[model samples]
Target: MKKACFCGTFDPVTQGHLDLIQRATRLFDEVVVVIGVNSDKHTMFPLDQRKKWLEESLKDLCHVTVQARAGLATEICKEIKANVLIRGVRNGVDLEYEKNMAAMNHLLDPSIETVILLASEDKMHCSSSNVREFLRYNRDVSQMVPACVAKDLKEGGKA
Candidate 1:
């Protein structure tokens, strides 16, 4: 089984993320969407809430599963027995950042290979940080995020 792991904070999974995961599903037998828990960083959404939103957004992807872990992504990949790491690159900056991270991950676990996928033209501009900022100002993020997440953000009255 070729299992790939896509790890991110996913404070609120955006359309770009969904697009990448959906594409990954076709390449790997199973794709594990691991939500990295970083206590040092101030996240807009709670871990459980983020996990729930991801689950709701990706429920239709039968081969994908969501998990929460507090550690290096490489470690999580080892725990899940995933040999591939899926990353989405939006532009040159993202590519540089992901390249460095991939090098570090390779050093930690050479067994796991990192696969970088370019963002689709339509969703290239959608990012979780931008969506969070929009929600903070009570702006509409329905176009950037999944419907379930947009509904939750609206109902939660984030400001």
Candidate 2:
């Protein structure tokens, strides 16, 4: 059985993230969504709230497991015995960053491999930050986010 890890902040699990997760689930037997927290970074949604959102977002995906972490992804992969690191790329700039990071991950472990997936056109423009921006501006973001997310945003559900 193939196992992989998807690492990110997931401040709010947008449709884009769900797209990637859905795709990853097809190629791997078990895909764990690793929510990493970086103290130096700032996010509109707190980690706990985001984690809760992710949990609800993935409650239906039996093959997908969501968990929170506080450090490097490379370490988590090693600890979990995962050989694949799945990432989603939206465009050229994203490819550049993801390509370099894939190379670095190889150097860090020499055993783990990074896999980059291009998002579908609809999801390419959707991101957590974008969703947050729309919400912050009081704009309708029902199209860019998942149903659960939209409900959360509407019913005062955190992140």
Candidate 3:
């Protein structure tokens, strides 16, 4: 079915993520947006909140679904029977990092291929970390994240 999986911490899904997922939907029949649960890394938002934000952001994409997994993304891809891994790169540094991860994922599972998508020009600077930083200072993130997320952040009084 040419299914693809895109995995990220998604502490808060940003517009860049939405751009990549939207682009991925055009290429793959099914795209699974996975929120990777890392026990060692602390996140600004809880897992359920992150999942809900992702779901709200991607509700219009019929062929896409949101899920949460507590292991390697490559393993999750295999478990979900996805044949492609979708990654988004904003610049050289991100490209290098994604390249290494893709290489390691290939070593782990040679059958699944990784597809790297460049972030949209407008969203190149948007990221979950940056959004969190803005929230920390009570800065407006309405332009960086989805409307639903922005509304939630404002209503929650995260700062």
Candidate 4:
């Protein structure tokens, strides 16, 4: 069974993230959405809340599952036995950053290929950080994120 892993903080899972996750499902038999926790960085949302948002956004996907971990993405990929690691590139900068990460992942596990999917033009500008910025000022982010996430941001308050 070919399995792919999509790892990200997914602090507030954006539409762009969903687009990639949904697309990955078509190519891989199973897509594991791993939410990586970085202790060095400050996350706007709690790990549980982030996981919940991902679950709600991806509940309809049968071949996809969500998990939370605090370690290198390559390690998580190894644990899940993923043959591929899926990443979404929104722009040139993102591509460069992802390229470096992909190289590192390759060093850690040469068997797990890193696949980068360019985001659709409409969703390219959407990101979890940008969505958080919009919400910080009380702006509507329904277009950048899923309806459930938007509702959660409004009701859940900063997490």
Error of 1 at 73 (Å): 1.0
lDDT of 2 by residue, 66-135 (tens): 8888767788998887889999999999999999999888888878889899999988989878888887
* Model 1 CA lDDT for position 13: 91
Candidate 4: which stretches are off by over 4 Å?
A: 157-159
Q: How displaced is residue 125 in candidate 3, in Å?
A: 0.8
Q: Clashing residue pairs in candidate 2, if any? A: none
lDDT of 1: 0.92
Clash number for every model?
A: 0, 0, 0, 0
Runs with alpha carbons beyond 4 Å of true place in candidate 1: none
Between candidates 1 and 4, the TM-score winner: 1
Q: Could you give the C-alpha RMSD of every candidate to the true structure, in order shown?
A: 1.1, 1.7, 0.9, 1.5
Write out the backbone clash pairs for model 4.
Answer: none
Model 2, runs deviating above 4 Å: 157-159
Which has the better lDDT: candidate 1, or candidate 2?
A: 1
- Cα lDDT, all candidates: 0.92, 0.86, 0.93, 0.89
TM-score of candidate 2 versus the correct structure, residues matched by position: 0.94
Q: lDDT by residue for model 1 over 65-153, one digit each (tens)? A: 99999899889999999999999999999999999999999999999999999999999889998888887787899999999988887
Could you say which candidate leads in TM-score? 3
lDDT order of candidates, top first = 3, 1, 4, 2
- lDDT, candidate 3, equals 0.93
lDDT of candidate 4 over 1-159, digit per residue (tens): 989999999878999999999988889999999998789989988899889989999999989999988788888888888889999998999999999999998999898899999998999989989987887887888898888887876686643
